[model samples]
Target: MPLSEYEQRVLEQMERQLSSDDPRLANTLKHRGRRSVGRYVAAGLGAVVGLLMLVFGTAESMPVLGVIGFVVMFAAVAFAFANPHSHEGPQGVVEEDGTVRPAGPGASAKGARAPRSGKQPKAHKPGFMDRLEERWDHRREDGR
Candidate 1:
């Protein structure tokens, strides 16, 4: 079904707005929805190879090779599903917590993200081994 003239105009306006907001992301998205035939072909080929390896390993009673084949199969499936090109670009600010956010014109010059919470990270206490070491040091100091 074809979109009406009004709908078309609205869609075009939205596209223009998106491109203006973030041109880099817009370009990445404009190419495609990020899925390609080449990716599927690679994954399929990997799966086939892994299956053959697994069968051969089982026939030969090589458990290690079988395990490796399983791992390869798992890796191929993971590669197929994974999106390597996420929207996060070089200009995005990576927060301490690992979240990427777009940088605005008035973004911080220092590039250091200020903690949102007023409380700072607490100082860690020494573990049991450290306490034992401290005790040993104290005994040596007293003997000296």
Candidate 2:
């Protein structure tokens, strides 16, 4: 359900206060929104297609489309299922019994894994055409 105007106002006030104090808390709040409806549709379509394939007994060829649908539906369902909205105050990090901690020096919780070592490096290989495209992009960005 959508928030009422009054609820929205309250939410906005809370968000502003939270954001002003700790930007990270604000960032987390920014992501709260309704889940995509497309996911449920995709999942339903996939199940139907898979069922049709089964009924037709064309398991070899016709089943491919059904399998594809299933994959798409699974992806959509996964996205929908992985909701980040929580009652937890910020960063989804909460103390036992669910209280938000104020941000401060040494505020970080223990046992958090250090950021992973460099898993990706910039690629240095750009062909002539790629460089030209990059230059074009830069020109557009510069409005020149």
Candidate 3:
């Protein structure tokens, strides 16, 4: 879930304080958001392969194959989740004011910066739940 405005402010305040107090630690914490499409694809493929292995192993009465399949599936999921966000971004590090700075010295800083989002966009557009929530929020705002 996304943080509320108040919560977000508090978090940013905390970050600013941290950066001020410990530059090294703040630098360590500065990172890009995770959104790896390739990793997701690999994980999905691995899961399917694992499932086939599991089914065949069981049918063929090979406990080892079943175990391997289970391992592969587990590993695939683990691998997917373990992967972090790509480091490549126009904004390499966030500043004390929460604005992003150019990732590299070579990157141009002439244009206005794009707004950053906490969450990455998904392959599919917003689904039913998202629309329902939007409507609900609108109704609440309208005091209906």
Quantify all predictions' global Cα lDDT against the true fold.
0.73, 0.59, 0.73
Write out the backbone clash pairs for model 1. none
Worst 10 residues of 3 by lDDT: 106-115
Q: Can you write out model 1's per-residue Cα lDDT over 11-87, one digit (the tens) per residue?
A: 99878876865566676587555577788789888888888889989999998888888888888888887765434
After the best TM-score superposition of candidate 1, give how far the Cα of residue 144 lies from its true spot, in angstroms: 74
RMSD to the true structure for each prediction, in A, is 19.4, 22.0, 17.1
Pick by lDDT: 1 or 2, better one: 1
Distance from true position, residue 114, model 3, in Å? Answer: 36
Better of 1 and 3 by TM-score: 1
In candidate 1, what residue range of length 10 has the lowest lDDT sum? 106-115
For model 1, what is the alpha-carbon lDDT of residue 29? 86
* TM per prediction: 0.47, 0.28, 0.44
lDDT at 36, model 3: 59
How much does candidate 2 score in TM-score?
Answer: 0.28
- Put down candidate 2 lDDT per residue, 1-144, tens digits, no spaces: 999999999988877766755666566566555445675566667666656655454555676666665665555456556653324355545543355545434344432334446666546666445778999999999995
Across 23-123, the per-residue lDDT of candidate 3 in tens digits comes to 66676567433445787899999999999999999999999999999999999999887735233445575543355656655443433344456856546
